[model samples]
Target: MKPPLDLDQLQTFITIADTGSFTRAAEEVHRTQSAVSMQMRRLEERIGKPLFEKEGRSNRLTEEGERLLSYARRLLYLNRETLAAFDDQRLEGTIRIGTPDDYADRFLPEIMARFSRSNPRVELTVVCEPTPGLVDQIKRGQLDIALVTHNDARGQSEVVRREPLLWVGSVNHATHEQEVLPMAFGRPTCVWRRAACDVLDGMNREYRILFTSFSATVITAAVLSGLAISVLPECALRPGMRVLGEADGFGPLPDCRIGLMRGQTDQPEIVDALARHIAESLDNISVPALDDATGLGFGAQALGRGRRGTATILPGW
Candidate 1:
């Protein structure tokens, strides 16, 4: 009988599937692209089938690969469960995680779930606040760690993800075509709000803030209801909303960076483990920040030439 398929190899396969790029998979697995290719070759030899085939610009999975995917995911889940079941450490601690609601909805599920499953005794406390607020909480030692967005390029931040801030409007309404663009944004201190207004002001664009709320959902509702167009991360663009572009004549929305910030308190081993899980959960994300070619493809003309759809696989980021 052939040797059993390796769990790590299966994970690599899943990462490639999740990321849709070998380079990204390599980054996820902390290996070289050549190493991933070699693993694929080994996996193919064991199964007597080719798993991947080259497609236009991307290496798409072959039919055989697709068939293997469902099995691989099941096997990996079982493997993790088995390990967790056997782990004797039985870690117990409290983890106070802070994140903006936008990110809380997009990114924390897998990290929290896995951490909870492995360390059943660990109590988790999640606080949903704006990025600036989260950072403040961390600074005050009120939060164990926080995921936040800022223009901080110094040693103070470890970038976990980058996303484009696009001009978003409702699909049925052409709210962006008005003489003076009406905007719905978060609080004045919001990084995206600051970036959007600065860019519009610098370009001398006529605009007004029709609504302001700290809640992204509310801002999204405003856009979806045709109340006003707003600046939002690509991840925040729901189905009913359309992305505005240079062709639309609106000023550019600057990209945002999400970073992992440590608190002032000393981190315990459990906290370190949780941090590792957070990093691993967000690995290999392909966030093309505002590249017209394959980025959001917001423009009509840009959408015509192959659509480079946004990656929602990073889950909640």
Candidate 2:
């Protein structure tokens, strides 16, 4: 049988030992110094030994207290691990998803592959569209979820990730100011194109639209040939591209939102599993700063092949 534990006493003991001062321990645990002193006294009594010895204004753990410190950390760590284990098993549902073309190219493939391995039964239907198109599809209930670039997600979907949009051009191109730049993007329904235009408009900058295509490949190809510059997500800066400048301080663009849209009733078990897997997978990815490039060859080789009708796995879907 396990011995009875006074958790409060044990916690107080650990806190005081860690901080090496009653006053500091009290501050850390958000308790009054007098209360902390009383808790420590009670802990000593329960253990039937002196846990600390006072020297001047500070405290030091006695030999017994030192021994107990190891046990305390193990206990707290085990408690958290146990809680996480239970939660990990509780999530299960099919999450039909739509997202922007760039997101599919940059980050979704690895995430999807990992998700498939972890939750094989989850039927994931991922549609690659421009950000605005994805948002529209979700609103119309054609998609159960969408990952879009909308700031605030106000009156819309849930924002999952926020990062700055940046200016990118082909390495071969000499970048001009916004006024003289030739631009490439998806069709008019693209939020990134809108954001870029909005910025240029506000700055009273004149620019020309060189190409429009839903395919990231087309836009990238055009940009690579020095036909245009584009405002793109930081992650989209591959080796062939160069950052001309930081984003022209547009109002916060919509974050990459992974919204749990209403009215999805596929295989509940499968949907839930996929959603959980996605959430977990995304959490593990570290979004790097715009200054340091994540490099190309991630999807460029396969994507650059110019072959259509190939089966591909997208991320947010």
Candidate 3:
């Protein structure tokens, strides 16, 4: 039988895949860039396949690398679970995590469930708020960690996931055809709201903010009620929503980036464990394909799964 894969090398590989840079992964894993490169080379040799390829200034995983990623995550998770099972002193503390309401709706359930399973002794305190407030809580040391929309101007964060920001309207509504487009949007501080306004201004499109709210529920209600249009990321797409493209006179928007912000805390190990769970959970999320008929990217059937009462809206903009 072949030699077992090295867990240390596998961890470094996963970090590089998540961060999209060997250099950054080095920083995360507390190794030099050259050391990280050496570990990856050994990993590739053991697998007998090139794991990464140069893409612009960063590294993109090769097909083999993509295939190995799933196995790597599962192996590491199993290792953690096994260790926790027998360790009487397994981490036990309260972790205060903040996320915007939209993110809480789409992502928190899976994250919380997985983290709780692995670290059952730990208590989780979840706070749902907008990104700005979450950031403030992080700065004030009130929150141990936060999942927020990554904005360089706001502060630094570890970017975890990204998806296309699309214009969406009710499938049954002709809101896009209106001369003065009515739109529902988040507060002015929201990056998505600013992006939508800027894009419309550049296109000289006549539009009015029909509804304004910090709550994703309010904005989603406006869109699904056939009263307004809005911009949202891929994961946020829901059954009644139709994505608007260039054919609909809507310009393309920037990608929505989700990130993690950690505050100064005494419980470093607990915080790191939670962070890993969040990253893994978000990384496993599959982006659905765009539908040709209604432009509802995951289709109505896919959106119908386990999404009974959830509102389709942008997360933590």
Candidate 4:
């Protein structure tokens, strides 16, 4: 009989694969960088196969590693599920969560409702704020978990969903066609603001920040009312908003990852449970929305494409 794979080691392995680096995986799993490396070495020795290979600076999984991924995932899930099922006590605690109104408006309430049903005793406090401000609150330990669009990859932050950034405008307005584009954007610290400006600058297109607000509704209303247009994730594309691409003389924008970050001081068990729920919920959202939504796409059906010329877009800029 084969010796069973170490469940703890497998957990670390999965985290490394998810985050793309040992340093990041360690941060997510609350382990040291050296410790994660040691676990990987031991795991490789036990399996009698090398699991990773260096492709430049980043570590790419080898054939053996690739094969183990599905099995590892299943084992980890079963182990956790089995353990939780056997536990007699119900989970209960107060979890403070922060997110931008954009996400809060669409997804947060539903997530909160479901989580409450599962964890009846666990109180949840939800806060709405811009991504930049939420990160600051997390760092200060004022918030337990934050749903954010991060410019920099840090922590064991789980990326819940990936969507393209789009230039959205009112159906009634020709805001995107202006010589100096009038736009609504989040404050300076918002990653969307940086991404939108960067893309426009690369195209040498002049733009004016006509309306600036953190509220997604305000921003959406501004665009819908023909006050100004703004850049938004495809998933958040409100109904009746016209997508502006090359046809509208606007450049393509970089994609954004919706990430979940837990506070350093949050109760591990509570945060872990809630995080798992959030991940599952977000995963469920990607498929149908991609297929059913007319303008937004999951790579195949693009919401925005330029007919005249391709705008120079720097990925991850």
Query: Highest lDDT, which number?
Result: 3
Candidate 3: lDDT over CA atoms?
A: 0.85
RMSD of each: 7.1, 12.5, 4.3, 7.4
Give the clashing residue pairs of candidate 3, or none: none
Arrange candidates, best lDDT first: 3, 1, 4, 2
Total clashing pairs for each candidate: 3, 11, 0, 3
TM-score of each: 0.68, 0.55, 0.85, 0.66
lDDT of 4 by residue, 1-317 (tens): 98888999999998887767888999998999999999999999998999888877677789899778757866765676566555668687788999876677666655775566566778888888777678889988999898887666444556777777778776666777778888888776667788788988899999889877666557767877888878766566654567777877777777777789889764888888888767645644432333224333422256432111111111121
Candidate 4 stretches greater than 4 Å from native = 1-86, 153-156, 287-300, 303-317
Clashing pairs in 4: 28-156, 93-122, 246-306
Q: Which stretches of candidate 1 lie over 4 Å from their true place?
A: 1-81, 153-155, 283-317
lDDT of each: 0.72, 0.59, 0.85, 0.71
Comparison by lDDT, 1 against 2, better one: 1
Candidate 2's error at 301, in angstroms? 25
Give the per-residue lDDT of model 3 (tens digit) for 112-212.
88898889999999998889989999999999999999899989999888777778898888999999999898888989989999999999999999998
Off by over 4 Å in 3: 1-4, 18-42, 45-48, 55-58, 288-294, 298-312
Output the lDDT of residue 120, model 3.
94
Q: Candidate 1's error at 285, in angstroms? A: 8.4
